[model samples]
Target chain A: MKELWELFSVFFRIGAFTFGGGYAMLPIIQREVVEKRGWASDEEVIDYYAIGQSTPGIIAVNTATFIGYKKKGLIGAIFATLGMISPSLVIITIIASSFMHFKDNQTVQHAFAGIRVAVVALVVNAVVRMWKKSVKDLVGIILFILAFLVIAFTRISPIIIIFVSAATGILLSYRGAVKE
Target chain B: MIYLYLYFEYFKIGLFAIGGGLATIPFLQELIQKYGWVTSQELVDMIAISESTPGPIGVNMATYVGFQTAGIGGAVIATLGLVTPSVIVIVIIAHYFMRFAEEPLVKAGFYGLRPAVTGLIAAAGFEVARVSLFNLQEYLDTRKILDIFDLKAIVLFGILMFVTNKYKKHPIIYLIAAGVVGVIFKFG
Candidate 1:
């Protein structure tokens, strides 16, 4: 019971504070779960992230579920998942109720205009950081460019892109192994 | 009936919205077209609020849409439906594939997926930039080249980029600064 409460509180704090979503939540997750709680090792957290991204659902929630299950079990997963989403539930509800009242306010409009542009910069920063970490070799570069162009230009689904890239990776690695 | 519909629709979104939070945008767009639950303009506003909020954009969006369509109960139900797949899948992976990462094929999959995810994120960034920095629809209507560029927004973006790279502060700081500037200059 105590452990479940702890899990909820830790993830609740993480969910409440982190601003930019999956990638931005990493540092806080590392701090609370890895360093402070010793729930999982650094490498394990990275693995969880990789798996979380590859799996269906939001990466942040998926990661919380993985770590929670690792610590306790099904019950732990429930508690952690609840904790992670609770903040969004509360905050968004408040905003939704209030936003209608101020939706057309001139000051609010100006603030959102600024906020939107700032968000663009933030997303661009995330891209640069992700690029350095993920795009390592020639094959990676090609995949990155191809995925970007397809997603930007066409109506093709990203799910298809992810599956095709995974297949390509397997085939490429298999051929390289044969050559060696 | 509405509750069931919310649960079913969001369940599908959770099942398929791989990559991350921003990936759900396309799905939400489809929902708008199909259900007319919210207008396209409202969707844009929701995205703005989601980006600036505390939690994952996907969860925030689910809450927003649910609240719009129904009420607080709807919000809770929608959120639960969206996360149900994730909870089930993660638990299954934990129970069945304890050593999943050690598998060579899984490693290979990640090797390919990393770059692909990067590209997806880049595309998302581009889409956000398109809406925030340019008035494409306005330009198309006016047929004016200068009307295409939001010059003030571009300037603000450049300045924020410089500050972010140099200072490395928490993102909220930049967001607040931008909001202040926007209020003063009446950006919109």
Candidate 2:
């Protein structure tokens, strides 16, 4: 029980201080979990990170679950995961509730309009980065365009596109078209 | 009933959004169109706020949507919905990931997944960009090409796009800069 509390508190601090998401949380997690507490070694931390990134869901929560379980089993995983999310749960609720009250104010509305465009800029930046990282080969390029066009032009669900791409990737790998 | 629905829908998001916080945008866009719970502008605002504030964007977004729909209890449920899959899936992966880490199927799966997810995000970005920069309603009413563009928003988008690409600072910095510009310009 003491260890569980410790796990929660440690993750709570990491969750509270980190800005951005996924990759942003990695260094903080490394400092707290590896350097400070000695919960896991640097190499171990990197291994957890690899699994954390590939698996489904938020990377931070996934890493927390892996580490927590490594230390104290399933219950520990629950506590650590909860700790990581607790700050987000509290902070977003407060802001969301408050924003509703001020949403009608003219000044607030103008600020949001500007912020929205900035968000578009952010989205464009994200796409460029993702493209440079993921869409490397001809097969990847085809999938990228196909996925974008299908989702944008048709009402077909994004999930279908994802599954089809996964299958294509697997088939290509087996057929020796791609070594990855 | 609605609470359960929120949980289930977000659960789907958790299961599917394999990359990270930003990856959830496409799924959230689907919800926005299917359910009318939030507007396109509101979704953009949520992205800004979620990016600016601390914590994971996925969790923050889930909480925001939950609160908007069903209050504090709703926030908890939606958040749990989002993280539930992470806890379950990660626990399982931690046990066998060492062996599976080098497996070809796993590598190939992600090889394909990474690009498609990129495409999904790109599509979603196009949607966000369209909504932020265009005035579709006025264009529909007036049938004029000029009515399609919001010059103020377009200018801001252009300046921001240029500066952000060049500077490459934290998103919070850009968000604040844009907000101040909006307030000064009174774009609303």
Candidate 3:
């Protein structure tokens, strides 16, 4: 029980301080969960990250749940998810109540203007890393290009893209074009 | 009652957003357009705020949208709604992820998902870029152009890219540097 509480506290700190979303959260998770606690290995963290990305929902929440569940079980997942979200909930509430003009301030705007570019770069970093890991063959490469074009240029919904892509995978598997 | 609606709405967002938080963009755009809960400009502003602040952009956006529609209680509902599905699904998978961690079908599915998610993430990147770089007025007539894309942003992006490539450092270093630049250029 004490260990579980510790786990929750650690994750809470991570979720609290982490800005710019999942990619930004990675180093923190590595520090708390892997280096400080020795709860999981680097490989395990990477695996959890991969699974977290493939699954639905926020990557941070998904990652916390995976780690928490690995540590304990059902209860751990609950605690981790709560820990991940608690800061955002509290902070957002505080901002909502007191700071209606928060963004209007010049300092805040400038900071954000800087961060916005960083956000794009971070996203680009993620894409490059995933492309290196995921795209092995020509078919995967072609699908990658097609999906990028469809969403970038067209008004088609992303859900439809996911479905079509998944279906194409299933078909490719059936034809033995790709290996499991 | 309204809270429940907010919960279920974000639950849907949680269940369907395959490529993570950014994938929530198109869905949120649809919701804002369909419901008129918030204005388009507000949504853009929310993105700016969400991206610049802490936490997941989707969660922040959900909270903003909920607040716009229903206030504090709405924020809670929307947040819970967004996260609940992840909690449930991860718990269930955690129960079995070890036993089937190397299963072929599961591996195949994720392998396929890799390229697809890459595509989704790229799409998201481009969409945000479209909003950030290209002004609507600029498209209609070049004469009506605004300084939508700042040179500072480009320089920051280029330098960060160089730093990231040259030496592996924490993201905080880049964020801090950018924050300082923002203060000097925009704040000062």
Top model number, DockQ: 1
Pairs with backbone N, CA or C atoms under 3 Å apart (clashes), candidate 1? none
Query: Candidate 1 on A98-120: residue-level lDDT in tens?
Result: 98655667887787678767877
| lDDT by residue (tens digit), candidate 1, B112-134 | 87787778767767776787789
Task: Give the Cα-based TM-score of candidate 2 against the true structure.
Answer: 0.64
Q: In model 2, which regions exceed 4 Å deviation?
A: A1-88, A95-100, B1-78, B94-98
Return whichever of 2 and 3 wins on lDDT: 2
- As for candidate 3, its clashing pairs are none
Task: After superposing candidate 3 on the true structure, give the runs of residues whose Cα lies further than 4 Å from its correct spot.
Answer: A1-60, B1-52, B61-78, B130-149
TM-score for each model: 0.76, 0.64, 0.74
Spell out the clash pairs found in candidate 2: none
Candidate 1 ranges beyond 4 A from true positions: A1-54, A67-76, A177-180, B1-13, B16-58, B68-70, B94-98
What CAPRI-style quality would you assign to candidate 2? acceptable
The TM-score of the first chain in every model comes to: 0.66, 0.57, 0.69
Candidate 3 CAPRI-style tier = acceptable
Calculate DockQ per candidate and list them.
Answer: 0.53, 0.43, 0.47
- Judged by whole-model lDDT over C-alpha atoms, candidate 1 comes out at 0.83
lDDT (Cα, tens digit) per residue for candidate 2, span B1-188: 98998999999999998867878999999999898888989899899788756688888999999999899998999999999999999888777764585788867766787777667656766675676689999899999999999899999999988997788565657766888998999974
Winning candidate number (lDDT): 1
